[model samples]
Target chain A: MVKALVFDAYGTLFDVHSVREKCNEWFPEQGEAISQTWREKQLNYFFLRQLMERYEPFDQVTREALRYACKANDVTLRDEAEEELMEAYLNLDLFEEVEEVLSQLNDKKLVVFSNGSPVMIDPLIDRSDISGYIDDVLSADGVKQYKPVPAAYYYAQQELGIEKEDILFMSSNPWDISGAASFGFRTAWINRNGLPKEELDIQPEVEYENLKGLLEWRD
Target chain B: MVKALVFDAYGTLFDVHSVREKCNEWFPEQGEAISQTWREKQLNYFFLRQLMERYEPFDQVTREALRYACKANDVTLRDEAEEELMEAYLNLDLFEEVEEVLSQLNDKKLVVFSNGSPVMIDPLIDRSDISGYIDDVLSADGVKQYKPVPAAYYYAQQELGIEKEDILFMSSNPWDISGAASFGFRTAWINRNGLPKEELDIQPEVEYENLKGLLEWRD
Candidate 1:
C-alpha cells in the first residue's frame, strides 16, 4: 500500500530486554534497574530535548540517562559499566524475527525511523551485518525531536524526500503510532504489550502483535 | 525572592509514596506496578495530548492510565478499590511537613500549579481543608495543556496576571522545574529524590531538599 515501510528500531528491531539481561551480568548489582531507568530516561530525554529545541546524539542521552538512573537507584558505577551498557546497547541482537521480516519487506524500500542517534543505530546495523538490506536509517538527530511530534514524521519525510502518504510507518509505542497516523502516514501498530488503543483522537490504520503479524498481512 | 510561591501537589505536597501504600492495600497483587504504570501513562497522556493540540483533563488521563495499567498488569479490581484509587488521589494526605511550611509561605501569593483537573485539585484542597489558605488553585483546566508546555505556564501566568519573572515556580519533578525555568519563571527545584541535577539546558535558581528548605530562606 505504501512505497516505503519505515519501522521503529529499539523495541521492534532490537531485543531491549535482552540487552538489559546481558548488562545484568557485568553490573550484577544494578544492571536490571540500570536498564529500566536507562530506557525510561531515554524516552524522557527524547521528549525533553524535543521540547527544549536542542538535539544530541542518542548515545550521549543514553549515557546521561544511564548516569541519572544510577544516581536515582543508588547504584554507583565508575565509567566502566556506562561503557559496558553503551557497548551492550550498540551490539543488541535483532529480534528473532527481524531479519526475516526485513528481507520480505525489502521488496519495497525498507527504512528505520528511530529516536536513536546515528552513532547508536548505525553501528548496530553495521555490527549485525544488515547494512545491505536497509536503504536508509533516519534518526531524530536533525530535528532534535522524537516521534509523536508531527515534526518528527516530517523530518523523516523531508530527509527521504518522499511524500508523507507514501510512507508506511510502524512503531511499538502507541504514542508514536498515533503521531505518525495523525501526520498523514499509513501506520501499522506493533502492539507488543497487548494493551488496547488509547482514547486518542487519532487511530492507527492497522494493528499487529509484532513484525511477524505485519509480515503475514498482505496489502 | 519572587512574589508568588507556587507548589506542585502530587509529590511535593501530597506524599505520593503514601498514595501507593494505600494502593498496595487495595489491589495487593498488582497495585504497585499498576500505580507506577498509571503515573507513567498519566504524564504520557498529558505530554502527548499537549503535542497533539488536544487537551483533556488530567483526571481523565489518570483514570485511563489506571484502567490501562490494571488491564496490562492483569489486576482485576472490584468496585470500591477501583474508585478508592481516584479517591485516594484527591484526598491524598499532605506530607507530614506540608501544612506547617505552606502555612508559613501563606504570607506570599500562593498557588497550586498542577497538571490535575480543577475538580481533582479543588477537592484535594477542600478535603485537606487548606482551601482558605491558598490564594488560588490553578489547574491546567482552561489552557487544556498540562505543565512543561510554554502554553501551560503562559496560562498560569495569564491567570495570575503576573509577570513571568514575578512567579516563583516550585516542583518536586526536575522536568517541571526545567520547563518552568524555560518558561521564564524563576524556579526552586524540590529535589526530594535526592537525584543529581540533570544536564538540561535549563537550571533552577534555587534548590531545596524539600519545601522546608524554602521556609528557612523565606523572609
Candidate 2:
C-alpha cells in the first residue's frame, strides 16, 4: 500500500512558465523565447552541476540560467529586472487542478520533493492555497545532490520514513520520472504536455495527465 | 609545462552540426532545428544516463536522441534514413583547423578523450586526415562514466600516465571544458562560435576561438 505521494514541485504542481509575463514586461516580443530557454538551461545547469560535482542551490542555478537565456535571446537583463524575474518564481501560479487534487488526497501524506531550494519553495508553498494540504517539503539542497542522482531520492525516502515501494513519486518532467523510477519508487508521470515518453530505459509505473489522476490510486 | 593535450572529439575536433546537410536532405527547412535538438538531447541523455547509472553506448544514445528530435520536429524517420544519419556521425567533418592544429602540435601527446563509444569514435578518427597526428583515443565507455563526471577524466589521466595539471584539455563545448577544468586539468575553451561563457563557477584556464590557439601552448 502506498504511504505517501511525493510530487515534484516545479513543473508538476507550479507552472514554471508563469514567469513569462514578467519576462515579457522586461523584453518585448521575446518573453516566450526567454522563458523557454531559461527553463531548458535551468535543468541543463542542474544536470551539469550534478555530474561535475558542483552543487549550487536552485535559486542560483535559476538566475544563471536566466542570464544565459537573456543572452541567447539577445536581450539585456539589468539587476532590477533580474531581481523582479527571480521574485516571480516565488509566486509561481499553481496548476489549476493542484489545489483540488491535493485536497482530495489529504488522507495520504502529500509531500513536495524538489530541487528547488527551501528559500524559494517554502514561500511558494506557503503562498499557495494547497499549502495546508502538503505534509512536508523536501529539497534536494538538503542532501546537496539533485534528482536522478540516487542520493537525492534516497534522502527523500529516508525523510518520509517509508519504503520506496510504499511511496508514489510524481513528476511532470520525464527525466525526473525516469530518475525516480530508476531509484525504485512507484512513479506516476504527470505528463501535462501530452508528450511522448522519453527513451530512457526506465519506465514510470503509471502515467497521469495531471494531478487529478492521483485520485484513482487506491491504498 | 603541459605533457599532453586531450581533446573532446564531438564539438572540439569534429563539427557535430556538419550532419546538417544530410539532415536538410531528409527534412528540408527543419534540418538545422532537428540537428540542434538531436545534439542537445544526445548530451542530455548522456548526463541522465550517467546520473542514473544507466550506461548505454554513445551510438545507441545518438540514435535515441535522433528519434526524439525527429518526433519533436514532426518528421518521419524511416529506418533507412535513420541509418544514414547514424552513419553520418562516424564520418563527421573535422573542424577546418583541426588537422592543421594537430599537425603543428605533434610534439606533445595528442589524445582524444570523449563520451563517444569507440565503435563510433574509432572509425571517425580513422577516417580523418588527422588520424596520423593523434596519439591515443580514450572513451568514456572504457570506464562507463561520461565526461563532467570526475571518474571519466580520471580514467583518461590514468590511461595517459600523466598528472592532471600537466594536461591541457580542449573542447568547443563549455560544459566539457568546465568538467575538465573541475577535474584539475588545465582547460582551453575553444569558443568557435564566440558565444558567451557559461555561468558555471568553474572556468577554463584559457579561451580560444578555435583549435589554432593550441599552437601557442608551449611546454
Q: Against the correct fold, how does model 1 do in TM-score?
A: 0.89
Q: Write the residue-wise lDDT of candidate 2 on A52-151 in tens digits.
A: 9889999999999999999988888999999999999999999999999888888888999999999999999999898999999999999999998999
**Model 1: colliding residue pairs:** none
lDDT of 1: 0.80
Clashing pairs for predicted structure model 2, backbone only: none
Q: What is candidate 1's CA lDDT for residue B150?
A: 80
lDDT (Cα, tens digit) per residue for candidate 1, span A8-107: 8888778776666766676676667777887888888767766655667788888888888777777676777778877888888787777877877778
TM-scores, all candidates, are 0.89, 0.95
Worst 10 residues of 1 chain B by lDDT: B14-23
Candidate 2 Cα lDDT to native:
0.92
